[model samples]
Target: MAYTLYYWPLPFRGIFIELLLAEAGQPFEKKSPSSIYPDHRFDRPLPGMAPPYLVEKGGLQIAQMPAIATHLAERHGLMPSGAEARAAATKAILDANDVLEEISQNGGVQMWEEESWGEFRAERLATWMRIFEETYQHHGGPFMLGEEITLADIAALGLWAPMIHALPPLEEDLKRHAPQVSALLGRLAQRPGLEAFLTAQRARDGQGYCGGEIEASLREVLGLKAEG
Candidate 1:
């Protein structure tokens, strides 16, 4: 089956699916809509007005990060087997998405800069981290679900990783207070497949976050080398 991912190639919302595919030990084609549309031309069909969409074999197209993630996990057996466990994992992914939406509405560029933006950003980040911390602690550390990694873990980690570019302080915060999450990231960093993908991405995108210092840190933490 040919798996084609259509996104802006920013690793923003799309990286979640990318990480899932990486951890699944599968190779898929990444199609960047922004790059194709930059010259005011089209190379493929647009998935509605949204990005980070996926088109599978038989012309099956799906959009939304959380929806795509859940679909992939269930289809590929990356999700939990037990019905209850599966429900919990799905709920956790949606919860994470809710937090992300809050951030996008308040902290993202959706609204003009205001004093509340700073407060909202901090509060929401802390809330999300705390949620993960509790889940990690309850699940017995290392991963969100359990010792065996699942889609929930990948979903949380993938969604959170790219956000580090927007909020550089989060790395320090996670390191200081949420050592478990940091440790989980360390484990994921050791995956050679993920390492290769991240290395190529950093090389092509350059160091630093947002196309600057956080990007370097991301590469370093992910065990990726800088570009020439």
Candidate 2:
């Protein structure tokens, strides 16, 4: 049951794989950017393009966050069992990705402006969160897909961690506009496996996800000072 995960040292996209493994209660070895050897390069072109890959028994390799996450979830039965639930889970993941894209702003340049953040807080943020909330309520709460944990829950949880980490200001807004999602922050943290990983994650790296390169740029664009 040994497995290996590869990703950049930062928690950004890599953390999603970790969340899934943790939720499954599966043990795995993780390799970060600093850990990979230079000669690890292939003599020929390889199948993969970037980090956030996973390796399993029989030398099976999986790349891309979505495929890796879906494979792991389906294999571990963390994916929804019912068709309707599965569809909802898929949609939930898409919604999460869209939010990630908007917030991340691609290539680590968050072009956040006062007006942009204001409009997002007023318009986009609540709408996206409400989408997740409705699905959670429809599935009957506690988990995104009812009693069973699904990839969507892991996806949503992973997405929230980075956003909260990068911007503390959003915390107050989240509680006010998306209370259900805010409540989930506590619920997901209490999961035994996820709890251990979070404790470890907090301990291991002082560096924030996406780091100051993006954070500084975002702060500048947002018209914040050296410290925010």
Candidate 3:
């Protein structure tokens, strides 16, 4: 039985899970978050505040992107062997999650102001990029864990690819601050399965990254024309 995923119609956290399933050539069913909100409250497979939920064929339901990612990586042979290596992988996923939160300005709890946005781009965002770059360099290669393309690599791609794709200006920041991470993204994007999945995603979303007012605020701060 294929897995089932619950997420909004955006390529944010959900993309990480999709990339993993695509790389492993595993099939999954995608459902909108609204499908479980008929009563104005989440009718989730498991109790969770928000989505990016994964329901396994064996009746195990999991929430939280990091937990779901680790579960899928372990089950699909995408995680590295041994406790230490697995811990590293988990760290990478959590790091990716943190970066997402930071970029979204804590889920857009406060809209980005020009001054704050500038500061974040120059400092915090640059630091996050360097962190990913240093991780790739420490591993010594194309993949995050060195030679093998594990979920760490996938997580990195999920974190940056959509961001760069949607906000083309940030591509320069990534290329400059995290050249190694940028290259890894290029390599990962070339994978046949991942490539096809991204192609379809782009066709459907058209550079729509993390949809909503937060995204609009982001685009504005970047001086890009407001998206519809």
Best by TM-score: 3
Give the per-residue lDDT of model 3 (tens digit) for 1-228.
489888877898899999999999998888887755444334555556677878888777877899899988998989998787687789889998998898888888988889999999999999989988888888748589877889898889999999998899999999999998898899899999899999988887788887788999999999898765
Clashes of each: 5, 0, 0
| Candidate 1 C-alpha lDDT tens digits along 151-203 | 87776676566565445556776666567876787777677876777666656
- In candidate 1, clashing pairs total 5
Of candidate 1, the 10-residue stretch with the lowest lDDT total is 206-215
For model 3, the stretches where C-alpha displacement exceeds 4 angstroms are: 37-45
Q: After superposition, how far is residue 72 of candidate 1 from its true place, in Å?
A: 1.0
| Colliding residue pairs in candidate 3 | none
TM-score of 2: 0.83
Model 2, span 1-228: residue lDDT tens: 578887765667778788889989999988764333344534212335556667786766766677777778888878888788877777766676667666656655656666776787678887787777777667747777777678888877887765665566666766776677678877998899999998798666543655555656555554445432
The better-scoring model by lDDT among 1 and 2 is 2
* Each candidate: RMSD: 5.8, 3.3, 1.7
- TM-score of model number 1: 0.76
